[model samples]
Target: MSKELRINSNKFIDQTTRLSFKFNGEKLYGYKGDTLASALLANNIHLVGRSFKYHRPRGIMTCGSEEPNAIVQIGNDPSLTDPNVRATEIELYEGLEAFSQNCWPNVKFDIGGINNLLSPLLPAGFYYKTFMWPASFWEKYEFFIRHSAGLGKSPTKPDPDIYDHKYYHCDVLVVGGGISGIMAAKLSAENNNETLLLDDKNILGGATIYQNNDCFQIDSTHTNYWLEKEIKNIKNIKNLTIKTRTSLAAYHGYNYLLAKENLTDHLSPDERKGKIRQRLWKIRAKKVIIATGSIERPLIFNNNDRPGIMLSSAIKKFIDFYGVKAGKEITLFTNNDSAYETAISLKKSGVNIVSIIDIRDKSSSKIVKEVEKHNIKIYWKHTIVNTEGYRRISFIEIMQLSDDGSGVIGKKIKLKTDCLGISGGWTPMVHLFTQSGGKLKFRSDDNVFFTRQE
Candidate 1:
């Protein structure tokens, strides 16, 4: 972890407080400002979870709502163990317990990992085809399959925490806390728009909090200085409500969104003083500008399900945002420029870089130039043919791809690497827009889904 600490706010918290928590039945400690993800990382616990399919090892991906891993079972009771809850979004509270899912014995050395070797016979939709003929046999197979499938166990007892809902009217509801979202909320609140910024992260500032690239020149003062300034300025604006650690679960008619606020999750599990544990806010907004930004998509290839291999978005949060070393050495593979930024950031951590493989033959991207300046080996028009790793990554075979990056044309180049950060480009988070029944138009250049003007 980086020793250069940067404190961004004193509004919500002012002291370096400590909290106790449990993981996989073991007790641990975390700070007040730490998210469940950061707290887990701080405990030097990697492999916070297991993969959905294949039962592979998994860790925290994105720092905010885009987190694809570190989903765990919490609390002693199955009902209180929040399934699919993002560790990156949960605040650290005393007695908070978490466990990795999808394993019979444990997350590591999962007996289900034997399924990886048997994966050749179990292709995608294998159960759909194979389990049909012996429908009666499927009943028995599904019984074992369901037991082998999914992570975390539900609490058998009823939830002890009280959860409730309330109605809140606001002139502006910012769905994301990214750069654009923060700026938009600032303008709206300044104009007396009764603004409310909603973020799924324990802290705000979405991607800007993680990304270290100079694409937009985000002020590197840490903890989103601009976000703090805007929120500070809006303190007296009577109508502005900044809800952090809140997710807009559902959208109803009249531009109303059902938002869940985790109020006492970061304190003590028993600290609810008649206050709702989780409050559902029914927010009615005058206008909803979805600056929700985008999520990093992983490039599909053979053996991409390996333990250490992860999305480029995850590398940024692990290194830049949370000060956690993602791995000893990293190999970043991408079809775009952002992966280069991940490589550079990791290089600064004194970790060795095996190589940066790009799918493009040539490009004018500034990231390309930066990589060249660092003298890092760049294999253009190359893609991973296969990855080899057990329990963790050990090697990846890179093959030079054709100009369109669809086929291999040159000899294969195999290199030893621990991690492979894959970036297939950004997917626009248009869930809120789609929830509003908005139309969508495809962007050929970006090749991503986006909301269309209705």
Candidate 2:
């Protein structure tokens, strides 16, 4: 059920090898390098699941670890079926079966949707407030409450996968495998340090690897090309060890860390037999370098959680990295310059860019100037007031911001766009840094809290 969203050819995805998988019992096809989320978007399957409380529709929100929706159950076996797995993280494999969660009788026509109408009577913690008053009927209410709660089912039998643990000590440990992490690993290793780099991905190089823009250059060469050359240089460093598909789980005192390294999650069932499925790494490093990058903040508006609404960064990766078009007609909304990057990428791919709605006054940056050259429509000081569409976004209503930027002042203008990409700038990932006895200072300008040093 491919929607023909794929571009002609992509070096990253192996289109020659087509693998079929099941989603809600219907077979779908994806390439060797496609994630379950990317494949669904390619098949034009939005509105994958339903919200837990109100049963409002939910779709694949993000492309990576920060995904808030698109959770599904994998497999049908009593012993091997895995639940609560993020669709964005699961790599496409042969014979894989995934079903949407949090709904009964399927996601499209869930009976639990009645709760949305009853939402006024079922606010947060309403079950505790409404049910506990009559203590005599507690047992009667328990049966119905338990049946209505929780997502996915637990395995009925013992897990049949192998799990192992190991220990190591390194002079320096660098987290994240983006361009910054790659350079950090290489520099640490070059100084005769036993450096270890960890990234929770099957492939190395983060979002920067897919950045093929002409303006993003290094020494007269595109940044992607330059970073690829650096990746090759780090592989030969004897003191450096790079571990992909591994995640750091905990940070303990005395420079001790706990990491989970997946061994065969991406491989097919037959290929995974008798192999270590996952390995827990207990490492002690003299020093730790946390280069865990930032996450793009999303804009908030009425009905912003619609299926076709996604982060601008995610749309960029879907096209440039996965070689899939998010939508045939797309519009972007932003308060920063990042969404312009998405607009440029979409324009280069021969996709129709309806327009760009920026909440701030116009400024002429080099990238913004380049977008102006394309003669794309720009609505300055405008904000999305509401979105329209039942399952996927079909139209967006925008209004010019007031002089004080607190309210709307002009008449609402409606635009037809299948996909809406919104960017609210980036928030630095400082959880690991703050967890290790570090404090943070709130930066209100960009709406981010950054680590503050002593």
Candidate 3:
């Protein structure tokens, strides 16, 4: 109920149009353009779900489809209910009903939470080892196990929503709507080619729209300002068609692909009546440009899966685009320079940044200096060994990295924190390429799997 965490800023959200929704029976309010995850974060509700095996508390970890947690059941009616919907992808709508999955009774105080205390007894293959005796009795063991380990429940009744399919042919098809994809579409259309561009978000500019910092510039203009101008230019091209909220689901040989366009998911229940819920598009293009962007990989550490622990890039998006702060006090842990931008953004937004723990020993990057100039502390050659707090992160135990960078050394230092944003690096979006029979090559320096060129 209280929009205490919501900041008064001219971001993506329309402050005048307020939408009310319910999560686990509690009514909450958000703005017109806020996603379900951003709305929840604006209300300071982070513990959204529970893990499958241990039943540990989980939270919204990302701002997009790469989210590993924060999946919930949407809608109240049995036939209209959809399960395992990513909160990051769901748009906030009036009367939207959402409930966390996998936990018995409720997410906060779940009975299945006992499994966390019994974790030592349940290893990775605990089921295979414990259920092995008497192969004939395996059926009995499976019945109980099946009831315990899983995500949201599927609707027993038939789905009432309508879905249809279509076919299209284009001279050039761009799989992403990021800065690169938009430029590619513009260039192709200028050459008298029919260009079609697709993106998963409701907006076309992609991540470029959120780059509001002064560190990046294009021809003496801020990157975000320049990108907005470019997007307007692309919109004026007659031969170019841009489709937002359209996801490419499958890619086959000979430049053939399948995409799904969301039609009414962002609308209110009353407005969505009699409208198509989704449409499948079968595309045949002469040339396809795979401009899908990269995904930020989360750092691996002890108790890293706890609630309130999120990706650094996601934190930036929530702050810069949605005008929401993840926490009053935040600690960022990163291996590279990307997170420094997030630190600067949050600092400028009046967030109390506890410190930035960089695994690298030293950095003279301009962004790093900018963060330092803002009086934000930076811990170089340090890594988090463990974290504290049950439902949400309260503090973290950090230590100096070993000389060879294989382990941690020295005594642990504890710092109070409400949120931890970690950035391990990025993995290129190569799913479409691999699905189309393209081979991949792993880049050791960046620890990314890239498409192998002929």
Candidate 4:
């Protein structure tokens, strides 16, 4: 449980304020602006919960709303207990109580984990097929099925948290608060258009907000610093309304949308008194800008769902934004140049980067060249065939990619690492657009889908 307390850290987090919280009955301390996932990683507790079918150990794999694992029950009060909450998205606060979900006995040692051994007999949909043989017997099997299902426990008492709804109408609406979203909002407001910018995160600037790299700069200033000034300037704009911790849920006809705004979710329970916990925002805009940004697509390999196997983008965020190191020795695997940026950040933080396994033949990008200058070992045209570890990743098996790019052609090379950062590029977040009847065209070159603009 070592913390990388680099003096350069704390751009987003407040190291001055330490917060104490509990997970699975174990108390831990984190900074004021930390998330449960980040704090847990900082404390070296990767195994958080168990998987659905096999009951395999699941960890904090991502750092945002897209996190599929690390779900848990929040609080123990009958009226206030929230279930199946994403730890990555939840803010860390004093007296915050959370417990792992879907595990009997405990997350560390679960009886359900035996499902992995009996997996052959179970197969996919084994429970459904085996129990459906006799519909008459379903009545007898209903009790057992009901008991084993559900990820978390529902509250028995009525909810006491305050929630409200509101409506807004703006000339232009931006769905993201990233760099592009900030620029779009600034321009729209300066042009006398009433602009509304919404982002799911409690803070603006998206992933680029923490992106600290020499290769990424604007107007001779670092991208993050430059964006800070733009964000500050937008605050005085009369026509602009910036809503952080607000997520656009739906996009309907005539540019009408539904967004959920978290008013007091990040606040302490005592501070939340007389305050609305959440607000449902009904927004209408004459024009909409879909700057929802992209999410890092994770690469699939054997046992990729292990506790410490995370996306490179996530690993970067854990280090840069939260001021915490994901691992002492991390191995990065990628097919693009994105991983190089993560490598630089890790190296700058004094974390040992075991090696970089790249599937691409090579890259001449500035970021890649910078990584080369650091004398970091990069295996070009190489891919990780499999990763080894149960509760967490211990090492990965790598080999040279064949000429046809379909198979491995060399002897297996094993690399020892505590954490694996994988980058499969990114997928454009066009869900709202597609939900509103937008069509997509697949780009065969980089293998991503984009809207077919008019």
Top-TM-score structure, candidate number: 2
- Model 1: per-residue lDDT, tens digit, 1-454? 2222222333333236657788888777766666777666656555777776667777665566667777877666656667777787777777787777777688877887777778788899987787787667877787877876655666677777788889888888888877788778888887878889888766666766554455445355444454566556655666567788787888777898888887877667557567678888988988887888888898889978666677877776666665555566678898898888787777665667788888887779786787788888888878889988766678999887776655788787789986678899999988878888888999898898787876
All models: lDDT? 0.74, 0.91, 0.91, 0.90
The alpha-carbon RMSD values of the candidates against the true structure, listed in the order shown, are 3.9, 1.2, 1.5, 1.4
Instruction: Give stretches of model 4 more than 4 Å off.
Output: 4-8, 134-136
lDDT of 3 at 337: 92
Local lDDT at 127 for model 3: 85
Between prediction 1 and prediction 3, the one with superior TM-score is: 3
Best candidate per lDDT, number? 3
C-alpha displacement of 128 in model 1, angstroms? Answer: 6.2
TM-score ranking from best candidate downward: 2, 4, 3, 1
How displaced is residue 233 in candidate 3, in Å? 1.6
Estimate the overall C-alpha local distance difference test score of candidate 3.
0.91
| Steric clash count of candidate 1 | 8
Clash number by candidate, in order: 8, 0, 0, 0
Q: How close is candidate 1 to the true structure, as a TM-score?
A: 0.85
- After TM-score superposition, the amount by which residue 204's alpha carbon in candidate 1 deviates from its true location, in angstroms, is 2.5
True lDDT of residue 402, candidate 2: 93
Instruction: Please write out the lDDT profile of model 3 over residues 65-111, one tens digit for every residue.
Output: 99989999997687888899999999999999999999988999999
